[model samples]
Target: MPEGITAECLMENIMEKISDNLPKQKNASFFEDDKSNSMSTQFNRLFGRQKPVHHLLGGGKSADVLLWRDKKISASCLTGATVVWVLFEWLNYNFLTLLSLAIAIGMVAQFAWKTASGMLNRSPSEVPHLVLPEHVFINIGKLVGVEVNRGLNFLQDVACGGNVKQLLGVVLSLWAVAIIGSWCNLLTVVYIGFVAAHTLPVLYERYENEVDGFVSNALDQFQHNYRKLDARVLSRIPTGKFRGKKFE
Candidate 1:
């Protein structure tokens, strides 16, 4: 009876021990989950973005079009861009020539409409001439100026920012762009970028978690490799000493 009682007591004690440790094990798992979440957040804030991609892109009609929130509008814009690209590229139409042709066609259509409308005893439709507003041009100039200054600032930062990885990335990107520009005309390059801008952002937003996780993993691996490279080679390179010129 005593042996059997001791065996029961031992079994109860083991159960109690396991019960006692279970919460700690759960807490350890929770801690690991929290750590991983923190790391993911850190990685995602790589460009210091704290807002949604749409908000970062201005959250206006332009953002909607880019992200394709309004499918009809987005599709129309894409269709229009495709038509322009076809006219400019496949049809080999010159910009000035196309403009003149369009104007001529409009004038002829208006003249015919006026003649038919008079015969039909109806009011003729107004002829629409190209009347670009001064304010529109000024607004466009401001936007272009802002973008140009922003680009200049980014280049300056890369040149003197002391972040070797960022500098390397910028250099590689510029080199790649140079190669692409060599292969295609400026309009084709711009059109390709327009298409990518229309597509990539929405996809990233839709698959935010997956994209962030994948990018974080890739970045972590890149940083690990970069650290090794820095340790082995870059760390040994001597920085040049700048000597100031003597005053005359």
Candidate 2:
């Protein structure tokens, strides 16, 4: 070969090798980026919570009580609940009867205190008046009203939203509640749930990792089964017009 032509051919061969290597490097980086992105895509934690359990519970005095940060207050709450359950369930006390009895006793005690203080020639200022601030009741009523409205709106939305999964979930939840209510009365169920609310969060917070891992595994398995079920059965269900987009 002539020297000039040989040099040109060699340069072309080198350029071709460089071009081929550049694409391979780019493709490798592209795949690496894709793999990293896939790895970074995290499934949701339990209940889809992105915050710590304390923050999710509002990170306030209420959360403190629920998580038993103040053991005394938490104990007092459980004790009070126990007392109420005992009163209604074991002692068979009607709420109206208890309320009336409590009011009557309070009135008698207040009257007796005033009479005794007067007979003792105690100063009028010595009599302490038991008074409730009106705003306390107003605030409580507002809170209750807001919660009631919210619950009603949620029920209405779930009823009319036409989401099968959501509807089934609500139905199953309500059905479970009904079964529990049948086992005991409403008060028993409420008390049990209140107790669980006080205890479960603390336990979950203590072992969040294990619980999360277990829940994640269970959810994955459930999703796997659900996909199979959807493909085999739910997908076969005739939707006709309802198969289209929900809102649009």
Candidate 3:
């Protein structure tokens, strides 16, 4: 009657109780057949078949980690896109040209983010489309994407510079641009479009992929741990008593 009693012990007790009521020979065969059948059913339930669609979509539980990951990525992209856009606007000085450029950046950034978001929302059965539509994203969004991507690239190059001098050179160049003429019309539109095409969603996508990977790894660890404990503890009771005589 303990909360954590083993299934084998519980089944043995049940068999003994049944034997007391039934003829001895009948009880032995009955218990043996019940054990075999219960094992067959358990094996089938554990590994024999695929999941139905209704349960996969609407059931309160799912075994697929990808489902959880897609949701997390979608949410992150939406939040990140909005926050980054707002911050870029606030941090950079605004004039008519700058505002126009910012508008262009956002327009492209949102679309880029949306592509990644769509992939995250896609089902496992569906094919993922990593390529973004150029026709849809206009000049302004392209510009924003370019700036962010260039910034990221500049950092990467600085990090991997062959010597300290080169690294310092890269840093100085960036500082000079920021201090002297980042606000000026650098014909930033062309570069922005090119960079946004590659960079914007890619960063968000990578973040999402990392989050999903982390969650998946964690869940796998939990299920592995639980299976080891559960088999020893909960898998031995009579099917009739715990799972009903017939599985529906």
Instruction: Please say which candidate is ahead in TM-score: 1 or 3.
Output: 1
TM-score against truth, every candidate: 0.73, 0.71, 0.18
10 residues in a row with least lDDT, candidate 2 = 239-248
- Per-residue lDDT tens digits for candidate 1, residues 131-198, read 87899999999999999988987787667656666777899999999999899998898889889989
Error of 1 at 231 (Å): 1.8
Model 2, 115-213: lDDT tens digits are: 888899985435467799999999999999999988878877777766666777899999998898889998998899999999999999999878877
The digit string of per-residue lDDT tens for model 3 on 112-211 reads 7778777899533343657977756787688889999888776665565444545656878879877756564343433344345334434434464454
Clashing pairs in 2: none
Q: Which stretches of candidate 2 lie over 4 Å from their true place?
A: 1-44, 118-121, 124-131, 240-248
- lDDT of candidate 3? 0.57
Could you give the C-alpha RMSD of every candidate to the true structure, in order shown?
A: 7.3, 6.2, 25.4
lDDT of model 2, residue 193: 93
| Top model number, TM-score | 1
Better of 1 and 2 by TM-score: 1
lDDT of 3 at 157: 59
